[model samples]
Every structure is written in C-alpha cells, then in structure tokens.
Target: MAALGWMVLALVFLDEVLAAVAAGVWGSHAGGWPLAVLAPVVVVAVWWAFASPRARWGGPVVRRVVKVLVFGLASVGLWVAGHHGWALALLVFSVVVNGLAQLPSIRGLVAEQERPPAS
Candidate 1:
C-alpha cells in the first residue's frame, strides 16, 4: 500500500511536469495552474484512500475505484472545457498511472481476504 501510494505520488508529479511543459509550449498560464493544484489533490486523495483507517473496507479497492472514476470524469470534463491537447494527454496519462498504482494494493487486499482461517 505504501509503495502504491508512492507510485501515485510519482505520477502526480509527472502530471504536474507534463502540464507545466504543455502550458509553456502553448503559452497558457491558466492551463498549468489547474494541473498544479490537481497534483497535490491527487496525492492527498490517494494517501487518504490507501492509508486512512476510516476508508471504506479498510483497504484500497474502494478508494481506488472512486478515485479512478472521479478523476476520469474530471479529465473528460477538462477536455470538454477547452483544455484540448494537453488536457487530453494528461487525462490519458492519469488513467494509466492510477490504474497501475492501484494494482498492487488491489492484489494485496484480495490476497488478505482470501486467506484461510487458522485451524
């Protein structure tokens, strides 16, 4: 879970970098600002979803699902809202990153749940 969280953090950082580069290339400061803010939110959301004891199921699955859906929708919305090229790229990148990051946690949770009881 910790490792997965870190992976999500790395992806968020990558997204920020990509957004900055895109913004610079396009000469759109507005495009970069939203991504800058979103990066931290992504990190926080991932951390809370994976690390927080109060999170549903006390595991990463539910959180990951929610994060994927929310982020996916948000990305599409951004794309529709005139972000265009960079936004679309970022959205696709985020989906891939989040999916990969959640894999380990989902596997671990499943393994734990599938364990046999002591004799």
Candidate 2:
C-alpha cells in the first residue's frame, strides 16, 4: 500500500512537472506549439539524467537537490501560466508529502525500495 502510494505520488509529480514546463514554453513565444513540445522534451531529458534513480549523477544529496529544484521550477512555471490554484496546491502538497517521507519508518521503506530485488 505504501509503495503504491509512493508510485502514485511520483506520477502526480511527474505530470505536474511536464504540465508546468509545457505551459511555460507555450507562452514564451507568439507561436508556441513547437516550443511547448520541445520544452518538455528538454526538461524530461534533464530530469531523467540528473534526478532519476538510474541517473548519471552520484550521491543522495545531489538527487535530493535536483528534485527540489525541479519542483521549484514546476511551481513557478504553473504560476506563470496563470494556474494560481494549481501552483499553490503543488507547493503545499509537495511540502507535506516530502515532509512525511522524511519520517524514520517511511525513510526505511524508501531505502528498501531503492535496493534491487534478489535474483
């Protein structure tokens, strides 16, 4: 159940990131369709490279920093796109959920999830 909740939260956060990037890029130019598509592609590429579990980057601190940076960008982008309610919700929910994730019990579960299953 906890793992499922984590997966759902991860998907929600990813969607929020994509939506925010698309919204920002869509408004950055007069004809934004192309840029909107390109923007998300770039963002996703960078995120996968730096933040994903299989990321090229090393160290837990770096991953945590990247996650925070991406979430911050997403929140700001949502605000720029005039989705004030969503922006606020994203920020608040991220704070609460991330805080909960820091609890000792949840932390152990997260560490376990990061480990590979025995073959």
Candidate 3:
C-alpha cells in the first residue's frame, strides 16, 4: 500500500511537469516563440511560489488550493491547444492521484520525511 502511495506521490510531480509542458504547447500555438518560452516559465514560477513543498508561504490548505489552480489551468491550456484528450486525461489523473496522495497512510509517510512549510 505504501509503495503504491509513493508511486502516486511521484506521479504528482510528473503531472506538474506536464502542466508546464501543456502551458508551453498552448503558448507555442498562441504565438510564434516568445510565449512558448514564457508560458512554462510562468507556470514554474507559480508552482514554486505557491505549490512547491519547500515554498516559504502557504500551509497545507493553501498548498492544495494552489495545486488545484495550477492543474486546472494546465487542463484548460491543453484543451485550448486542441489536445482535448490529453487535457481530460491529465485532469482525471491529477485529481485521482492527488486524492490518493492525501490518504492518511501516504500523507504520514510524506510528512515524516519533511516538515511542513510556513502558513
């Protein structure tokens, strides 16, 4: 069970990286080059500022909200970029994986390894 939980936890990071990729894809389609480069930078910045586990701000609740917002935006970006199937898949997978990661057994495993960031 813990192994499965850890895998799901790892998937969360992969999903986050894919979010940045989706943003880049959308930006590439929206503009020639600048946006393609800029979009993922913005996404990374937002994630680092609010969602990253070591971020200086935000408690657990805020962290969850930021994750949802980031994932939601990524899904929308994928859909707007004409990758509807990928968009839906990302959204569903993110939601399910994230929910699984929140289970007490899994959450405890993670919390034990790292102290929570500031609120």
TM-score of each: 0.41, 0.69, 0.90
- Distance from true location, Cα of 116 in model 1, Å: 23
Best by lDDT: 3
Question: For model 1, how does the per-residue alpha-carbon lDDT over 1-119 read when each residue is reduced to its tens digit?
Answer: 66666667577657544543443333333456566465446644654555334554445566556555545554554565567775677778877775665476644654665689879
Best by TM-score: 3
Q: Give me the displacement of residue 22 in model 3, in angstroms.
A: 0.6
Q: Which stretches of candidate 2 lie over 4 Å from their true place?
A: 1-31, 116-119
| Candidate 3: clashing pairs of residues | none
Model 3, span 1-119: residue lDDT tens: 87887888899889889989988988998895899999999989988988888877867888888899989988998899899999999999899888888789988878878976779
Q: Give the worst 10-residue stretch by lDDT in candidate 1.
A: 20-29
Tens digits of per-residue lDDT, candidate 2, 16-53, equal 46544644554464246776666667667767778766
TM-score winner between candidates 2 and 3: 3
**Model 1 lDDT, full chain set:** 0.56
In candidate 1, the residue pairs with backbone N, CA or C atoms under 3 Å apart (3 or more residues apart, or in different chains) clash, namely none
The Cα error of candidate 2 at residue 38, in Å, is 1.8
